[model samples]
Target: MQRKAPARGFEQAEFQARTQKAQALMAQQGLEGLLLMTEPDVRYFSGFHTLFWQSPTRPWFLFIPASGKPVAVIPEIGAALMRQTWIEDIRSWSAPAPQDDGISLLHELLAPLARRGARLGILKGHETSLRMPLGDWERLVRALPGLQLTDATGLIQGLRMVKSAAEIEKLAHICTIGSATFDQVPKQISQGMPLEEVFRAFRREALAQGADDTPYLVGGAGPGGYADVISPPSRRPLQAGDILMLDTGATWDGYFCDFDRNFAIETADDAARRAYDVLWRATEAGLAAAQPGNSCQDLFQAMQGVIAELDDQSGDIGRLGHGLGMQLTEQPSHADFDCTRLQEGMVLTLEPSLGYGDGLIMVHEENIVIRADGAELLTRRAPPELPVI
Candidate 1:
């Protein structure tokens, strides 16, 4: 059944609370302001949502001062839309202006902080970028001599890691749509169909089932198992003994639901069935370990312990799963090296994969949110045993 979509975009209060949270963290870190350039960061604080970001022709910027609402310094084309958002101070410039591209406006907005040599924050850590021309970045740095630009990856990402009640509602809605789309797979695919057509069928089904978009869809098929998880679908057709998997990142509003379902094309080998059971049980272990007090390291160990019963090497896929939200995969990955603690309202994915029988592999994934009580599943659970079409 089709679920009702959540209300589009957040209210002004939601953006205000987000800004206030970042401002409080900025205070603790001694940051006078945050300079945001990425699409996600700008939208998080300003609610300035647009597909205009698709073009790199114009760069956008959002500045969160020590007080008040966010300021948008962007191209003139976006001004009217920016005005519609909660932001009051919208500065615009005509663009492809490699000559001046909002640098003058940014300097004007931040010059006061520059004079005092006050510390400013921007993301410069893993999974983040400047999202602007390198030459322009140098010009802005040279223009503002005393402003100390520090990395705000931790401060910014920390706030985003946890979900608000309003945000959780959007995520849950999309997960339901994605789950409904997956449920149609058995009826939509067949043995003679090419893998590319299968991929197309999924995108169509996801959109029809009320997903805003199915931006991410990937997986593989082989006699017993697939080669890799991230490969694009080839023209190869499915065979009776093939095992197929489809993982998707489907969106509703601006939130995403990420998970996958595995199906046996006609029949399965004993080795394939056993691998599925091990991965299913491993995901169960991960769910049990996803509590408020546990760290990502603890979650990794819980899942890894079960996977070890099969592939002691764990198939070398690196991290088991990661935090999920605005982007398909966010920070606080489930891995031994990461010790980020689980907190209530944090959404995550439990993914387990193992290698068996002459270089073949199988992967399983489920989405859940960490809760005070424990982990709450977001996606419908896959069958305990692999289903044969």
Candidate 2:
């Protein structure tokens, strides 16, 4: 089925500014063009958005040269949509073809760059993966001989970390919606309700509160606390004295707000209450330390110092938090090993977790944008005390 493209997602000037920034980075890196195959990269530069990407049978490609407009090489089904974007060069072919698929077209687009001895950058690194199939990538590599393929992961990450004013506004709006939905938990949720039902109710509330979509929602419930941060909701009823945590990556206008809140079912235990306080204070420390010129590791340490005695459960949940923008999780992980500098305009999350008794854990998260003087909260600050339902 052919999909009609809506008008450009943002003003033309927004995309134009992004293109100029990317071109400047490409010039600094001595690269001729960027071969963007991921959804976020393609949409970021071209204002192209489609849920059609859910299928893996066909791959879409976007090429941003060192200068000038970007070119789109996508399936014919997406031609109408690509035309709606700022891109002018739209190359399409019948995709999912048993033999060719869109490989020939992609190779043709890159052949000229190869002939000119140009270095082409592709996103390949931590948290980044090739959207195209391995067989297709191998074939393209063989077809484009002498084309210098380099890791442009850093280049793309550097550009995406800083959110434009419009992007920040969208992010802040979604976060506000999420916070409102969470506010209804006390009234909407109750003891004995199944975890799965709680998940459904929370998602419905988010939608009712103006969320366009809820892409990610994972949570857990246990007597003292949850053992894992990313587990799917279970069918077990929410029992009294259990610590129930709900983490969501709710979206509005393609922008996502990633955060979570904890609720005590009926009553709370001393261990759970103390753990919540520790996590809350840790997040406060992170917020106080988040400013321009500070590194991500520095932020991690500040939070870690606040709860050093408590077992740091951040290792179990990956980084404390990560850069958030177009995707639910982006670059610049908030971990001791990550050295990415905290720059103004970067949107991030300060998540702090601690282990309580009986192998239980509690995680608290908040979203913020790095500002010139300090960090500005995106999501309304969660209540300092754990709210008991």
Candidate 3:
């Protein structure tokens, strides 16, 4: 017989606390149970972690009742991993079955709640995408009639928005590692280095500095500024007077730190320098305004007040910044329309962007945790002036 694997990830108590909190929310919302199909939600409540989610072939499901441990309906391939979590009522089926990928099993598991006229919750709102196939979801809906499906996006968002002490520690560790790597760019980067090589070196530096993974890395380099923020790196070579920005969503123990730093290649023009200064000031304004009892709109306005020619468009980058924890981007986006109140223990990023010369823009970002009195910075502060590499 093979030796059993030890339980990993968060402690049993942490998962229990999470389940209890989610249960209370479910009860308040009149939800009989929550059916989680996304990776973050399932892992958040069950402490199950796996990189196999990269493949979109098989869909995993977790059933969270109003007041008890969650039931994991996953594939047999993940049985060992699921067993290592705090969950005991594990139900496995041979996945990638093509015809029936755990749909029948999920229907059987949720049948009891449906019989009680209890509404089941699923995430189907803003910033959320159904993780399972449409045919399977439709089949499950038909399998259990009168089982009203409600949106649990708000409930899950509320629980994940605030960070526990342990989660905060993991995020801080990753942020520090990313900051250290950013500090080395001035020496490692040159005017003629290709953007692709720079990206590779940044990832290497992040791993060397103890980052578990560098999953999100996007940036651009241009003479005055970059046009798009989310574009992949091209083979374009850096030139004098170019402004380069690298934003990373590096992880430590599955927690992420989302921020970026800007650098000038050899030299920066007056327009670029001024734009950098404005962006830096905007970030400071956001940091000052991020505290308990404040609204996300308030933080957005505060940052927008300082920047010159601030554009609030829903383009490549939706909002100035958004809630960060457990995933690269969470909820309560810092946009003018969002009124979500900032509460203590919430981790967020203060990202402010402004247009520079014609069609070029510069952006600055920082990460912080909301506190009772004020905001506590997690990543090391960027220099007041953009460094010339």
Candidate 4:
């Protein structure tokens, strides 16, 4: 299916801004060149997409250096798409035939840098699996003997954590789609409707409203309704007394909007309402901790405090929110493992859900920016306790 061109927005300008932003990182890391093989990083630097990622048969990489123009090593079939991107230098290779070696083509792309000591940085290198086989790595090593290789994950993540103005606008537009689709969910949902059908309805509605991609959507409708944490939407039927929780996100122009709300099929039960109230309170605490100059851990701690107060002993995910921008999930995660401070340009989601015998309730909300005063709420309306239907 032909994807509708992204609406007139800030994506074009944002792409340029991101490239310039990465230039400084490359210089700072002392990297002669950086190779981007993963989806998020590839999409971040180059506005391109491909499903060829499923196989290691032909690996694609984007090579960027501090001082010069970037180059793309892609399959010949995708050469046209690569040319369509802003990056000017791209090399195409024919499929690996018995006569032609794929590694030689990759080395040919990187051969010029052999004299520069071939100090290359690979992002998400340790995490590559079948798509980037060991043979490819060995070929790169053998192709450039004595090359100094390093992990570029941190350098890449740092650049991505901060959102440019164009990025913020794109994300806000995605949020608009999510809010509009959510508003329609209550109207479309009904008792006895299968949960799977309801979920599909939301997906169709989101695409109709101009969603370029669906990044995250996991929810369910069971006897007592769905769980707190996002589980995949299932075939469970929506009983008259059951509650429905649909937490989903739509990615547009490389930006994402993650928002979820709980819907009561008929009447709001006392147990469900009470659980929702606690989750809402936790979400408020998370928002309060999102001020500029605050640590990401602080925001997570605030949410944890709420979960600790609950008498029930359900295991909490221990993180209040995560940064949302070009990728559905980005850096500065609100967890003990991360210590990055909040900045004015950062956008984050505050989703704190509690699961107990009282029935699961999710209070998912999101905010963008750490303003001079405080944080800005990106989501339209707060999640409802019950469906208005």
* Top-lDDT structure, candidate number: 1
lDDT of 1 by residue, 256-339 (tens): 888988899999999899999999999999999999989999999999999999984637788899989888999889999999
Candidate 2 structure quality by residue, lDDT tens digits, 156-247: 89999999988988888888889888988999989899999999999999888888899899989988788888898889999998889999
What are the models' TM-scores? Answer: 0.98, 0.96, 0.96, 0.88
- For residue 309, what is the lDDT in candidate 1? 91
* Model 4 regions more than 4 Å off: 1-13, 49-57, 96-102, 116-118, 124-131, 228-230, 358-363, 383-388
- Over 348-386, each residue of candidate 3 has an lDDT whose tens digit, in order, gives 999988775678877888999998998999899999998
The better candidate by TM-score, 1 or 2, is 1
Among residues 3 or more apart in sequence or in different chains, the pairs in candidate 2 whose N, CA or C atoms overlap within 3 Å are none
Candidate 2 Cα deviation (angstroms), residue 283: 0.5
Model 2 misplaced regions, further than 4 Å: 1-8, 312-315
Per-residue accuracy of model 4 over 103-125 as CA lDDT, tens digit each = 66667766777756766777663
Off by over 4 Å in 3: 1-8, 309-317
C-alpha lDDT of candidate 4 relative to the true structure = 0.71
lDDT of each: 0.91, 0.89, 0.87, 0.71
CA displacement after TM-score superposition, residue 190 of candidate 4 (Å): 1.0
